[model samples]
Target: MTDTTAIDIPGYKQGTWVLDPAHSEVGFSVRHMMISKVRGAFGVKSATLVAPENPLETTVTAQVDATSLDTKDEGRDGHLRSADFFDVENHPTIDFVSTGVRIEGGDFLVDGDLTIRGVTKPVTFDFDFGGFGADPWGNYKAGATAKTVINREDFGLTWNAALETGGVLVGKDVTITLDLQGALQA
Candidate 1:
């Protein structure tokens, strides 16, 4: 039998928390023309995380502005915002809401509903808790790195083209990386 009794974990903290977007980054990369990879980042608008006094009972929710997507390339950015891709005009935001969390090995799996371009899909990300510390200002802070890969088409991002030499202009698989910092709001 498994112990359902809640126990305080050494590094776990409870209460409302805010994502420090200035210290966080949302990045993604996908194969371009099957020969090169294009990478980009979106500025996080707002995020919040809550724990029920125990890390095992936690909830996370985040929202990101779709228009904040930047690749450092104007042409590509515009293309990505067009109907061929994100269609930002219609869907102005991307969001994630955690449904479950499970620890495996030394890491965690964050299972959530990821919505993009009005399409929602179940996504699971591998997460690493980077411990907790206090800042000079006396605020508690924690960090985490999470990553996952998904088919862009699954989120309604179906833009692509056949290269003259071989494969399509854009690859279907997109790898997402989230480097996050959270401020304890307890």
Candidate 2:
């Protein structure tokens, strides 16, 4: 078992950190026809991190433009934006609000509610602190990588087609990974 004591992060500071969208990415992968994986990314609308002296008290809120989903295929992208999938016209954004942070098995975990297609569900992300540093321009920045998986049908993303060979066109589980870089607010 891993220790549950408070973690010590070197050079950690308490302040509001605004995500640099140009340096951040939200990507996902889902099984296609139970044979291969279809990977894509979404454009972040906004994300903010409120770090406290104690890392466990940190909070995060983020939004992703659902309409910005791109899978390198225009036809498939259009279908995902339709009512058959994300229904982006009605739910133009996917939102996430952190509730708490903790350490499990020596790994950081951020618990939060994820809303998609207007349906909300609790999800936990495996968080990794990528350390704090300053850029050549002297801007203090923080980086991290987080990931989680959820069932598509749990959030009203249930549209799928049965394959002739017996599987489904889309997998139920989707893996979401986030690479975030945030600049400290002055």
Candidate 3:
């Protein structure tokens, strides 16, 4: 019998990692008036990740400022900050802490606790590993794209209005996207 180990893979090294916000983006989209979708991005302030050689044993934590929400429309953005929505004044930050990571068909399922508006819920995001490489500055960089969907109402953001057309003003489902880049920590 032959024992084989220590094969070098492109990525899968174990170490502490820090998110590079300048290269990362957290975005979301929600149904608007049942006729269109409104998209916005949250400036990911910071994040930390710890991964073993095996991607499955990874832990990730991130924080996003709720007040940094921007939808390209000031009026709508203001509404989202009020009591009817995120209530940025009360909940200044949104947080995520991964509980587990699983890989399926080359994709990853990152399960974590997501807190918004004082409500905490378990959510899972489908993530795609974008591989890893060394940067010009000698920093190892890893990239990933993640996506998930949740009901806004579940987070105590139930403010809504009835439209004359016989539907609610906004839909309940909100889709989120995360474009993340992490730099190897020394």
- Winner by lDDT: 2
Task: Give me the candidate number with maximum TM-score.
Answer: 2
Q: Sort all candidates by TM-score, best to worst.
A: 2, 1, 3
Tell me the lDDT of model 3 at 49.
95
lDDT of each: 0.88, 0.93, 0.88
Weakest lDDT window of 10 consecutive positions for candidate 3: 1-10
For residues 1-186, what per-residue lDDT tens digits would candidate 3 score against the true structure?
222223344676799999999999999998888999999988887899997776666799999988989999999999998888989898988999999876556555889999999999999999877989999999999998999999999999899899999888889999999999999998
For residue 27, give model 3's deviation from the true position in Å.
0.3
| Cα displacement (Å) at residue 178, model 3 | 0.2
The predicted structure with the larger lDDT, 1 or 2, is 2
Better of 2 and 3 by lDDT: 2
TM agreement with the true structure for every prediction: 0.93, 0.96, 0.92
Pairs that collide in candidate 3 are none
| Candidate 2 ranges with C-alpha deviation above 4 Å | 1-5
